[model samples]
Target: MRADAKKNYSHILAVAREVVTEHGADASMRDIARRADVGLATLLRHFPTREALFEALLCTNLDALTQTADELETSNSPDEALVSWFQEWLVFAQSYRGVVAMMAAAHTNPDSALYAACAEVHSASARLLLRAQALGSARADMNGDDLFALMTALGWAVDQPSFAPRADRLFQIVASAILTNPSSKDIKNATR
Candidate 1:
């Protein structure tokens, strides 16, 4: 892209990020265009569709989260790495309000614009789960898909005002359930 077009693309992405963070997966394309001070045609020229726009907005952060999994794999213990990555995944899933549904759909849909990025994230998460399972720390029956589903559920739960306050406790419960042997801290945290 030309320098000016590139600048506009970046600006639109920035504004879309803000809009999505506020309004979620249903954020209006027209609103995003208006907020970015661009024509709808210009925004559509860059993104083409809502999925395309979100793919551009989230791809960088998704890649970074995958890289974090890679780092944690080598630097942390298997259980610790898995737990840490789980937390990170939850944060990413909740970043843009109702984005978890998009992520879950993207994970299952090969044709989705976000599919490749979501696949990478899932693979990274699977590797962490494998490490923990091999160490006999995590449940052998639970695979990456299961973990992904759990994270998606927790992400949705926390998005609800009524359930938001229990997010941490619910996280500990799920983490403990995934692990074969819960740490004292994990058990205590879950109960609280």
Candidate 2:
């Protein structure tokens, strides 16, 4: 793609992501185009339909989470890295409340991009889980699918308006459940 075309595509995706996250999957592509300062033709050239755009947006977020997980692997302890990655993932999930729904739809659609995006998330999360388990910080039996399910449950909680206030607490509770010995309290007191 040309420089300007690439710039336009990036801008459209960014704006579309922001709009969809705030307004939901039903958010208008025309509005996104206007926000991106791109024409309808340009937007369509990049994303032919609403579902296509939504999938691209979902992929972008998943890609970012994967990159962050990769970076966290080197910078933090295995347990801390897992916790940090979950925190970031939950935040992204909460921001895009419709993601769970989209993923479910993707599962049945066969042609949906969300399926591939979800697989990417799964692969990245599995790496983190395995690393934590290898370091004896995470439960030995916990697998990638289990972690993914836990995340989905937490995301559902985060999506609820009533549960939103307790989202952070919920994350801590889930983290505490997965960690091996030396509970969060013990680890915190030890550090102090």
Candidate 3:
């Protein structure tokens, strides 16, 4: 890419990040272009679709989360690691407004732009869940896809103002349900 073109791409991505943070997954491309002081055509040239733009924007964070999951597996006990990663994943799911739907869709669609990133998250989640289940702490009936769906539902609740206040409580409830034998210390450590 030429210097000017690269500069424009970076600027557009930065502005899109800001816009998405404020307005969420449905944020308008035109508005992002306006905010970046770039033409709509320029924005479209760099990101042909909304999913592509979000995939680029969230790639770093998703990779970091997956890496964190890897580290937590070795550093924490099975239950604690699973719960800790769950909390982190939940926070990431709620980072941008209305992104849960995109994640949910991408999770099942191989052709989606966000599919690879979401799949990585799903795989990491499965590993943690499996680790916990191996220790008899987590429920054996559940899998990564179930956890992903739960996260999506919780993320949806967070998008609604009224339900936002209950998200934490709901999280605890869900966590408790996932863990078959959560000790007081485990719960305390996980929730923190």
Candidate 4:
């Protein structure tokens, strides 16, 4: 990319983050362009769609989550690692205003711009999940996709301001549901 074009792309992404943080993933592209002091065509040329733009923002965090899962696997017990990773994933899911729906859509649709990112998230968590299951920690019947579903539901629950405080309670319930032998110590460690 040319220097000026690269600058415009960076400016647009930065402004889009600000706008989406305040409004939502559904925030208007035109508004983002205006905020970046770029024309709508320029914004569209870089982003093409709102999903693509959000995917770009999410890709960084998703990659971090993958590394987090990897690091946790080596640093903690299987159950603790899985629980801790899921807890962190929940927090990331709430980072953007409207990312939950985008993630959910991506899960079922291979064509979505966010699909690859969603799949990478699943793959990362799956390693931890398989480890837990192999060690008789997590329920054998479930897989990474099931955990993703639970995370999606939890994200949806926390998406509402009225239910936000209940996220921890929901997390507890989910842990109980998924763990074969839930321990207070493991759960406590995960919360940290």
Best by lDDT: 3
Give stretches of model 3 more than 4 Å off.
Answer: none
Which one wins by TM-score: 1 or 2? 1
Cα RMSD, each candidate: 2.2, 3.8, 1.4, 1.2
- lDDT digits (tens) for residues 1-192 of candidate 4: 999888888888889889998887789999999999889998989999888998887878888988998899899999888889989988887778778988898887998889998988888888888999999999999988898898888887887798888878788788878889999777766666
TM-score of each: 0.94, 0.77, 0.95, 0.95
Model 4: weakest 10-residue lDDT segment is 183-192
lDDT of 1 by residue, 1-192 (tens): 899999999999999999998898999999999999999999999999888998999988988999999999999888888888888877776677777788888888998998998899889989999999999999999988998888889888887779878877888888889989878574453333
Off by over 4 Å in 2: 1-11, 28-45, 104-110, 185-192
Model 4 misses residue 5 by how many Å? 1.1
**For model 3, where is the 10-residue window of minimal lDDT?**
183-192
TM-score for candidate 2, residues paired by index: 0.77
Model 1 bad stretches (over 4 Å): 186-192
By TM-score rank, best first, the candidates go 4, 3, 1, 2
**Candidate 4 structure, TM-score to reference:** 0.95
Q: How many residue pairs clash in each candidate?
A: 0, 0, 0, 0
